[model samples]
Target: MIKEQGEGKSRYMPGLDGLRAISVLAVIAYHMNVSWAPGGLLGVAVFFTLSGYLITDQLVAQWQTAKRIDFAGFWMRRIRRLMPAMFVMLAVVGAWLLLFDPERLASLQGDFVSVSLYFNNWWLIFHQVSYFESFGPPSPLGHLWSIAIEEQFYLIWPILLTVLLRFTKQRGKLMMFILLGAAASTVAMAMIYVPGSDPSRVYYGTDTRAFALLIGAALAVAWPSRSLSAAISDKSRLVFDILGGAGLLAIVWLIWKTNEYDSLLYNGGLALFSVLTAVVTAVLAHPASRVAKAMGCRPLRWIGVRSYSLYLWHFPVIILMNPSGIADDVHAGRALVQIALSLLLAALSWTCIEEPIRRGFRSPFREKIQGWSPFQYRNKRAVSALALMLFLISGYSSLNADRPADPSPAIIDTSSNGQEGTTLPVTDPGIPAVVIPEAPIPMEPQPKSEESSKPATNAGITAIGDSVLLDAAPHLEKLLPGIMIDGKVGRQMYQALDVVDQLKAEGKLGDRIVIELGTNGAFSSKQLRELLSSLQDARKIVLINTRVPRKWQDTVNSTLEEVANEYANTEIMDWYSASKNKQTYFADDGVHLKREGAESYAFLLSKTLQGG
Candidate 1:
């Protein structure tokens, strides 16, 4: 009698899939910038819980039955289950990049290596990668950072658990202590460090994320046996279901309401929320919970079944369709299109790639115990060779790729001499004395005549933008000879506005404010409006519109034009159009100005300011 394929052991849990659906959907919505999914990133935490619980549950079951765990077999199973589909996805994406987005493709090779090697989190940390930087485009596999985190956890967690079990000699108690300690330590750390820590560090750190997984592990280890399961009455089960559903909703609500500013407290709350979910899931595994049955609804179960594929496909779809810089314009519409496309692609991937491979792994023919075990069947030499080849490909791409020059000033300023109300030349052979201007008279006291012979009191030009603007400063000063140009380089628009206000108060509101910004940054319309509006007193504010790659030019143009129209002092410098007509002005990066371009920009800007 062929043992009924899915008999005795309930390998299918609809609620777990429902939970996965929740996790993946939240992440997708968040990435799409849906107004309601503020905390969608917390979906990774949910996934951690599910992964910990399922893996630990399997391990505990094996341990109980066999009296020892086969670590090699377990890891081999993990590799086969995870790697094949991942490899296929990466290969497809790599090929796509080569055909359509070769420049971005070259940059993505490192990310491909990181994702394939399961080390993307470390790559991000080492590079200090910011999610907001206006690079030409982002990697298709940037979302793999979370996968890297999970894989990294698995590399150490199983060994740690095994060692702890050996020492404690009691699985339940050991997991209990680990769970309690993780939760307490995470909460404590969040309280202490999150207040001042960089938001990215807080978001990505394993220490803070461990508690969610531990909560799931705790449930698996401490699960009540069948005998005790009978003691939980129907009423208690109903209450657990209601409370668990409510808790899930509350967590979603919190995520929707919070932003990066509130992430510290919100993530802490998520830990508590995840723990509640684990408890509910563990208790509701019994056949009696109505809410659990509801979670097992056909649609949710299907979404959960395809969750991994959905997760993998959604981000790339969103990225490919929306592109960088375009997000502000088609953020909502592109998001919907991405979601629909992702679902279609996910369905195809699930039907053709993931399910087939997973099924093949579980096939009885593959499970046959030959003299060689599954671990031995895994060709270590082949795996190593593949890893090396991928690494080489990544290294080749990265070495060949053109990276930006480091912006840190090579020369340090050490001068002590102070000068007041002195105009410094751009071609300063040496660092000049710091000039302190006379006490600021009110703006009302200043004369407005364009030809007034009274010496111009303030700096003639003030350039503000990101690192790229720093390159334009010397030329700007040259064009406005002896005009005391005040350059606030490497600042975001809003931060630069603050500096502008301070300079205005100090009597440095120059006749012309040439903003050579846009490169190295992207801003929302609201943010750009606020920044432009703040420059109310400048006689002329020249917005040096950025010339981005063709893909992003339209977005840059639209945003700049909108902001310029809203402010009376603002006029777009049309750098994009100018650069097209004079290609020598742009650097190879296509964003920063070349030396000639900088000088040309300065010439045109000076003419504009002089009312020529």
Candidate 2:
């Protein structure tokens, strides 16, 4: 979407603004967890390419015309344009967390500092935090990592371009250097990426992700569109048409084909998508291109022009609007409200902060008077009032929200005979109607002689599990007293073997053992079989199946049932069945338990143990 101009410079292209609209919308849809846009995070790659093209276009023009770059002016403009709105967002979020969600404040303290310093990606990587994994509640500012990457690019790229220009004026050599940088970045990403593990490190690394930006730069140097467009014939125009359409379709197809779980994405899929985006950009850059005209429609261009503000505001707005997070009731109405509010905030930020700052405010009163057309003024005031009312309503609703009273479950160590921490009664909805047994099941006494004895007492019960198990540990202990519970966050099935061995060595291994693994990741039939072998020494083993919204849920449940059937000492606790339609019992993830869900989970386990 390059504008046709002479004098060694490109003018503003409306179609490029439209492309920004598409990219920002994709990112917003992804963050909203829309089912259709599973690969919407690819929007970041689009932004990287666009940033590369625009910045290089400006720098190349300066190098060719002025024979030097205005480094101070360029850095100042970037800081003024991007930092003000970002600072406002961070400040608002910090206040919100302090006022409404104090628990998340400590975790986000580092986020604030890192994001402010433009190295948040490295901070997350150093902490070994996966972007996809939520250890607790997610930070609203998590998306700032991409901004950090762009800022880092801005920091180093202009000086590098100046050096390149000083060394040689040949665009061919410049293009080669950019290509080599892109290639090296791609190789670095592939080298560090491990299949089947979290790809956060590769995804967040600046050295790895710089390829997308470099690829865009390479495209600019290789195909300066004003020159290429004049050389094209009618037959070549047809080729451009096909290439443009094909490139767009390829992006949509890849978005549908790949998901966060796809291992190939880190290996080469991202690089492929970036290349495809560059191709589409090249097509749009041509002045005679019809695809550019089509995408340059007014509505898309409007969104594109204000995209930076929208991107900055949309994520926090979504997070704040969801009073209960993924657990809260979600409908089209709430979604509409979220979209409207995001747009309003973006429009306000553009008018109030970005535009005025960009103009340098020679005289605020005269500018405000000049800017105030009757209709525009009324519309701005009306939207501001609406936004204020909505914020107040949101604050009231959040303040009076009926959150579960029980704190998150404490981590328990398997090395000792540890009882669970204190648990309060679930306060969301009253306890569901549970058929409590006439009395707690009486423990049978153990036989001193070699003869067979009745099944071991409830005192000889031990439970091992992941975060879900941790959520229910206190309730499980309260329901089945004296039971030893060992649970931790993000525990996987293979880790269970080690836990079992540890329990056995400590002589705390129980006859009736509850295994609540497989919530974090999928395990194979072979792994299940091996785990079953480890538990064979127990009198009876209970396998708790999962209800997570992940792709592996059915495989995990079926594998557990199949293995439980093969072993007479094993039985399945069908948590998936019991938790169906009981959305109030769980958090947004549908895997971890809230207070109501934790209580229900404990009741289900207790009932299963008591022959319910």
Candidate 3:
């Protein structure tokens, strides 16, 4: 997330920062858990390309100057520019968690070291951490995966460039080599990506993502920022603007259109986005481009200048502020506050740490510090005190790496738990039922209540669902005696229709059916509608909403509510709402249940059934 343009042979390009501004904002939008920008995560690929171009341009300039790379000096320069702000952010985060959230602090142990060493991406990969899945108390350093990938590139690309330079003096040759490498990486991503499974592996892998960086490197070789001419004819300028504007528009479109799970993304979609980013970068770096002038406007440039620190601080701000880590609902006012705070902290980090360190640690206000007014003096003191606190936190966090976290007792089924349930009693109101072209299915007798309706006891209640149902199966069984359950892992709503059909065929489908299917992921109304249509003949149907950490949780719940409304025999169990803010009941991932959670969930379902 560091600034693209560094202090080297390259001059400052404000347009490039504007691009960073947009990219980082997109990343923030994705994390904001909003639906509109599902593809906002692609912004990181833009950053990858931008970094590749700038770093390669700088390295090429250095090689042209001395005919040899100064590895130590280059590495030191990178460390100076990037490390201070990161250390400050991590330290501050560590201290906050240490004092108020000891469990989170203890959980951060391995993450702290991996981030410091810039190996967080691989660490997450080795651990198989799911980036898109909801795990409560999410790692504040989770977003640092991209930062780790970029840092790895920054370290290795320079050495590789030096080696490539010795083989050929031609930029064409260099461009060809980088493009080939990018192709190989893209192929690897496609090969590794498993449809309908978590894509975190390919998403976090440097080998798979190298194409984005390589695309930028290739662009720099073909069109170095320094080599572009200041004087350009109007005709060429029009071409630059058209190509640049179109490329930028395409990027924004992708940000709006796609999401992380789209199968094509790993195959070629991401590679295409990177190539477009390089086009925009090329146009912005050109002196003749008006697109660059527009993007370099003051507000955009200002944000661009501090994009790195903004990136570093934003994720932690979002995570810590909403520690429950349920991102399904959009809280606009809260989001605004989070955005404002992130900007404020980013500005502070940029002013106090990044700019000062990179520019040789000289304070611009040294002379004024001696003759400051009361307000200014207080401000300086506050800043200094904050800096001291951050310094102390970093050191303290290091010493307490092995400190034990405070223990938390598991939540008892105090009041009980669960999401969605029991609709009004079904009567003579006619609703179109789904037709099954099969012989009459046999069903065992169901015991009736004194009111002449089927009882809610387990004997006649059939529960069909995914892993969440299995997690709570013991309690469901205990709460309702002889409840028939058919739950499997990784099941979705689309699969439910067939399961329902099979149950009906085998005379296993009960008049009272409780389904908890969407926990694995999302489902369309078409899928839910089809499932509900088949169950229209049932005496009662309970559609349990999910509490998954995935972005699709909202989709699953909303579709259930909407489709359930159309069926007279249906009711939605607001399980997600009941379980909200009750992470103590859940396991670490927040999707599956602990013993307490399962018991509570079962109790809630029992109440819904008795009442229905």
Candidate 4:
């Protein structure tokens, strides 16, 4: 996907670029928060396999012709194709952040250095940055993790292949070696994956992801593109087309049906998908496959040709220019505009930068300008290079300049009656906020009956929740005296049942229950249902939805909305609606409450619980 195969039609496989088009499109769709493609993240895995196949094929071709891999030339070719667009992107994103949002710029230097060095994936992993757990504005360069993986493979695989070929020239044995490596990688991923934790460790690790690349490399070793002949029986061609088409359909299904967080994806599911992509790659490489002909149509080829540039530019455009505040989930019109901007930038980069550098910067106008010599050009470029570098350095330094911290968090008295408050600071550390003003309103769908069985006061009310509830506890107590509140830091939905059961046994289970969990991460609908069932004896239940700015923000709120609709006495208290876009009510980290937010939260819950 990074660069097209230069081999003529019998071997070049534009259908593979067709595959590139599909893969890149899937990734872009995922970034755009399109409803149809939850598994669009799998698109990166597809590109990994495609890259392994193409790069290995190119290397094998060189080996067949020259009897050795040209390590220097191969690496240079890679740099020329990949480096130009990326460096330009870095300079532009850096400058943009410097001028507009400098708070983020302080931390971006690491990302810049990691990307420049092609170790961004490792940087994220080692730094304990969770890819799925992002809360604030995401690093626009975050998607470069895949590029780092591919570049690492490009750097090492050729040398490794040389050693392997030197070890045993037999293709069968070579494939076996590569396949064994792939198996080890798959097993490592499965073994390392913890069911409920952030899967970023395995997701970003080079060793765990090597299986996809190795699968493609094995395919290339077993079926070199150069050796495939145009002469084939019609029956064989039909078989190729049918199998290839089926593989493509299956890939599409997985992209649509699956999600990144599903447990099965880590266990063995991704390996299976990688194998399917390789099969599709294999069929597309065959000379007589009609599937390849159809896939290589003009529109698909055009997109495929610019796929790498598109991939490079899409994420940045979305992060920088998104209209809606939910970060990834944009409205359709805004999504389309952002996508079009991405394409425009990609096309420009491909035409002006990527192609020119890869083709040795040979200008079409070189012939027109008489006496314009390479020597003169080099001298002028050298003189200008210092000034350009210094200008860039000065801008980069300004972006890194220290800024003032906000005034210390507001002093809200979290004390009420004889009960001591949880007195912790309400400011959640390092959680950036991208608040969406249009987040869902509370679902108080007409209750089956007009029964007004609301609690008169906090007499029989019990509030059980996470740190957010803790933040607002003092206000809740002040607003509704004698309301029993139980809250702890980082409490998730699963921990609520035990607390509730303990309270019941202690003769403290209130007839009115207010549950506010799932702020830490997403919980299953089953968990929510079980919690509701346990509180069935309560006269009224108020479900507080979350305002977590992380990826799970929508999931937590939606599941609460969905599950609350099923219960008769349950009603949602839309804290997210009250809090979104009111940044002054929040600490530096957007998710937590300042005094105003806590007071508002307490008042809202009081109103919702008392049937105001």
What are the Cα lDDT values of the candidates? 0.59, 0.72, 0.76, 0.75
User: lDDT of candidate 4?
Assistant: 0.75
Ranking by lDDT: 3, 4, 2, 1
| lDDT digits (tens) for residues 428-535 of candidate 2 | 222332122221122223344563453334677888886678778778766776677776655667567777888789887888888898776556566678878988
Residue 56 deviation, candidate 1, in Å? 1.4
Q: Write model 3 residue lDDT over 132-211, tens digit each, in one string.
A: 75333367788999989999998999989999999978878888999999999999999998654467889999999999
> What stretches of model 2 exceed 4 Å from their correct place?
1-8, 95-107, 225-231, 325-330, 361-382, 395-452, 455-465, 469-488, 493-518, 521-545, 549-574, 583-612
TM-score of 1: 0.63
- Candidate 4, superposed: residue stretches over 4 Å from native: 1-10, 323-326, 362-464, 479-515, 524-544, 547-551, 557-612
lDDT of 1: 0.59
| Pairs of colliding residues, candidate 2 | 1-284, 1-285, 585-597
Candidate 4 lDDT by residue in tens digits, 1-612: 333334211245778888989999999888776768878989999999988988888887777777788888889888888998999888877886777666667768899999999999999888766677554457889999999999999999999998988888888999999999999999999999865446788999999999999999999988888788779998899899999999999999999987766768899788889999999999988878899989888778778878898898788777766422124555576567667666766655666577667667676522222111222333444533543343344334432342225534422211111123344322222333222212112211122244335443556888887657767877776677668877755566766777888888989788999998766666667777888999888899999998765556777888899999999999999989988788777664456687899999999998898799
Please provide the root mean square deviation of candidate 3 (C-alpha atoms, Å): 10.4
Worst 10 residues of 4 by lDDT: 410-419
State TM-scores per candidate.
Answer: 0.63, 0.75, 0.73, 0.75
Instruction: Give the TM-score (vs. native) of candidate 2.
Output: 0.75
How many pairs of residues in model 3 come into backbone collision? 12
lDDT of 1 at 374: 26
**Which of the two, 1 or 3, has more TM-score?**
3
